[model samples]
Target: MTKIAVLGAGSWGTALANTMAKNEQDVTIWSHKAEQAKEIALKKTNARYLPGASLDSNLKATDDMALAVQGADIVLLVVPTKAIRQVAKQLGTILEEKRQQVVLAHAAKGLEQKTHLRISQMIEAEIPAEFVTGLAVISGPSHAEDVVKGDLTAISIGSTDDAAARLLQAALANEHFRPYTNSDLVGSELGGALKNIIAIGSGMLIGKGYGANAQAALLTRGLVEIREVGKALGAEGETFLGLAGIGDLIVTGMSPNSRNYRAGVALASGKPLAQVEEEMGMVIEGVNTIKAVVDFEEEFDLDLPITRTLYQVIYEGKTIDQGINDLMTRPLKAED
Candidate 1:
């Protein structure tokens, strides 16, 4: 059995741990809070994160970082983007103390603020190279709510190392959960991260009482913007057309299950960004990601109306109505 350690006890992390354990892998989930860990391990449920869901009996939970990764062959990180550096630093320290190496994969989907580094880049910078066999990212349209319920899901395992990607694929895939290997790590990571911005926009459309026509337009244009940004970052255009790209965008954009999408809905209801985020009780990656993408747009001098509008609305105190008008008033251009 592949000994897997999942870092984070949130909805996504807990769901992933449960799925892998059900697949018969030896899986351990680690949470920073001892109480949360005890709840999952002893109570067989993570009510705070995955309420109404039961964990697999075989899955283990712990608060100690060292204990979770002691015999881990594959370390899958599912923490928020903001926490990646800290978690990677802690994991690196534990690996160094044990003198052990393992393949590392992250499922977080956002770039770091100011630095604008992707999740994989953040992990690589913090983790010691000698303690890592390879690095990969698992992403696509799989939502935690659905995945934990045994719904059929498919995701992309992206890595520059073919062996590393294939290893993760073999360790995670099952009848209900399928993973496809892809070498376009850049595209895979960018696609998932960038789509959250559009998902927020999608939610705003519904909240604002817009019809299906507006949503179709938003998605189409949003994808064009995503592809453009991915291209500037050295990602393959074709990857944006695949599961990690369009697939993730569609689900996260359309589904109410997406935190970012829900964030948009709340924003459209005229709630302040702080209040919306505080009540949601989850890290809305798109809010932070909007800043990063806007930075990218200015640096590259690219036109991303949706992203810029979001930044203005969230950070600059611009009203949602004005933001929409700003987008609608932009100079006409042919669709790429």
Candidate 2:
């Protein structure tokens, strides 16, 4: 994987593209906005996403989808969940026109709203087998801010096919960036998407004047719910303890750099989901993830109290206090 195209010029996409460029890989990052792409080319800094961090001069940027996907050995999808389908569909159109078989990997971390599909699942649904030779998901606790700053960050790449995952692991791994491989796509994807929900809750807790004690309880019980849901979806029990599960949960739920966490603060301040997301200038995956989760719980008959409560607060116009009270006053049960 020397020739790589990173879709989306958001914080994560820019960071990963620079990382690969530093490792001496031929990289091009695609941005939907032409000005952002031009800025990346001329200025060599994505100030909107990564302020003050210099991008690698070797890295390329483009707004043309055909140019970005054409002849690339690997394509890394880094857009938010809402944009995945349109991007994948558009990528598929470009990919089908080419004869080269490409490996597709995604770093996006949320389920599709209406389809409730994982990012890889959505990609596969869009791209035919003739174009996409392999699919893998790169997830875990790698925050874009920390990653670009050269902080030591460990994450996981999961795939049913070992060759695809290993290819990405080797291509992405560096001294400061650790990429662990796993086979549980269900666990990995679910864990990655679901943690944002809890991250929003963590932020709401901070904004509501809740202490570390509450956050700890939330994280622990949240882990249990995550594991339960993963198992219900055919995920391995131990996957929850791995990088994609607990590792992702810890980082997204606690980190200030997380858009989901920041959105939680706004939600706690009695702001609407739309306003919070608009003000943050980024997609808050947790809000959308909660709606998908709420849909899944009803369709699958699963119990997700924290997720449900957050949905109530955000969608049903219920107060945060009332939602928390509902959670605390629930019936007692075993720690299992």
Candidate 3:
């Protein structure tokens, strides 16, 4: 069985780890919080993030990074974007000492706030090259809430390294979980990250009492915006047409389970951004993604009306109605 180390103990991390363990892999999950690690190990439940779901009894949990990663064949990163570099650095030090070569895969979706780097780029910047056998990104329409309930979930495992991608595909796939391999890492990563912004827009529309027509229009336009920006950033346009692109957008943009979408609804309900985030008790990646993508648009001169308008509503204290007005009033152009 493949030995796997899953970093981060949030809902996504725990769900993925439990899946691996149930697949008969030797899996260990790391949580920085000692009490959480103990709880998962002893109680077989991650109560804080993944409520009511029973983890595999065989799964192990640890607060010690070295213990979690020891003899691991694949190191899966499921941490938030903000913690990518820090976790990579720690993993690098441990791997260098162990002299282990392992596949690296990240499931997190978001760009770095300051550097605007993708999750893989941030990991590469901190990790020593010799210890990494391959790098892949896992993203698609799957949600932890559904996945744990044995819902059929399909996701793309993107990597330039074909063998590594196939390896992950084999290790993670089951009757309920399907993993497809893709070579367009940039497109895959961008598709996942960028869609969160649109999902927030979707939530805002719901909050403003808009119906399906508006959501359909928003998603179509948002997809175009994502494709254009991704192309400018060196991703293949066609990648956005696939699961990593439209599939993910559809699920996240429409689902009440999506944190970003909920964040938007809360924002529209007149709650301050800080208050909404506090109430949610999760990272809400779209908020940070907006800041990062706005910087990218400014630097590259890309036109992203939805993202731009959300920025104003979120950070500039503009009302949701005013933001909608601005988007509707933009100079008319042919649908790109």
Candidate 4:
């Protein structure tokens, strides 16, 4: 059996461990909290993150990074984007000497806030270059809750290294959770990061009781903004139209399980952003991604109207009504 190390014990992390465990892989999950590791090991469940979901016996949970990664063929990072660098730094200290052919897989979906670096870039910066055989991002319309229930889902595994990408496709693909491979790392990462911002807008519209036509308009406009930003960042244009872009956007925008969409709904209902985050009890990545998008817009001088409106609402304390009015009053243009 292939030995895999999964870092982090959050919902997505635990869900991934569950998936691999069910597939009969020898999976070791590293958790920062010893109690959480004990919970997974003793109870065969991660009740906090993956409530009511039982993990397979093949899955082992540990607090020691060295033990978790020892002899692993691949390291699957499911930590938050903000935590990527810190975790990678810690891994570097422990695994610097390991010469095993290890493929690094990440399920993180946001860019670094100030640097605008993708998670893979952050990992490369923290770890020795030669130790990283390849980097792959697995993303698409995946919700942790639904995935744990074995719902049919499809996701993309993207990497610049073709051989590594194929290896990931083979490792992760299954009857219920199908995986497709892509080589456009920029497009894949950008699509995953930017969609969260749009999901917030979608949730806000739904919370305000907007009709389907209005939701459709927001979704379409959101895609344009994502594409513009992706292009500015050197991503291939057509990649945004694929599973990572349109597929992720549609699912996150419409699904109640999406933390970003939920945050948007809370914002629309007149709740403060801070309070909404507290209520959600999970990281709303869109909030941080909004900041990153604003920074990117300013840096590239790109006109991201929707993202600008979102920034105003999130940071400037602008009312949703004002934000929506500002968006509607903007000069119109032909659909590209």
TM-score of each: 0.98, 0.97, 0.98, 0.97
For model 3, what is the error of residue 214's alpha carbon versus the real structure, in angstroms, after optimal superposition?
A: 0.8
Task: Show the colliding residue pairs in model 4.
Answer: none
Indicate the TM-score of model 2: 0.97
Cand. 4 TM to true fold: 0.97
Prediction-by-prediction clash tally: 0, 0, 0, 0
Query: What is the C-alpha lDDT profile of model 3 across 76-157, one tens digit per residue?
Result: 9999998999999999999999999999999999999878899999999899889999999999998998998889999998
Model 4, residue 2: distance off in Å is: 1.7
Q: Which one wins by lDDT: 1 or 4?
A: 1
Off by over 4 Å in 3: none
lDDT of 1 by residue, 1-336 (tens): 899999999999999999999989999999999999999999999998888998899999999989999989999999999999999999999999999999999999999998999998899899999999989999899899999999999999889989989888987888999999999999999999999999999999899999889888898899999999999999999998889999999999999999999999999998988999899999999888888899889889898989888888888898888988889998988878
lDDT per residue as tens, model 2, 1-336: 478999999999999998888888889999999999999988999999999988888889999988987779889999998889899999988877776688899899998887788888888888887887778888889888888889998889888888888877777788988899989888889999999999999999999999899998998888887887778778899999989999999888888898888888878987887788789999888788888888777777888899888888888888989988999999998877
lDDT of each: 0.92, 0.88, 0.92, 0.88
How does model 1 score by TM-score?
A: 0.98
Instruction: Decide which is better by lDDT, 1 or 2.
Output: 1
Q: Which 10-residue window in model 3 sums to the lowest lDDT?
A: 290-299
- Looking at model 4, residue 274 earns an lDDT score of 84
Summing lDDT over every window of 10 consecutive residues in candidate 1, give the lowest-scoring window.
Answer: 164-173
Point out where model 1 deviates above 4 Å. none
Q: What is the lDDT of residue 210 in candidate 2?
A: 96
Q: After superposition, how far is residue 182 of candidate 3 from its true place, in Å?
A: 0.1
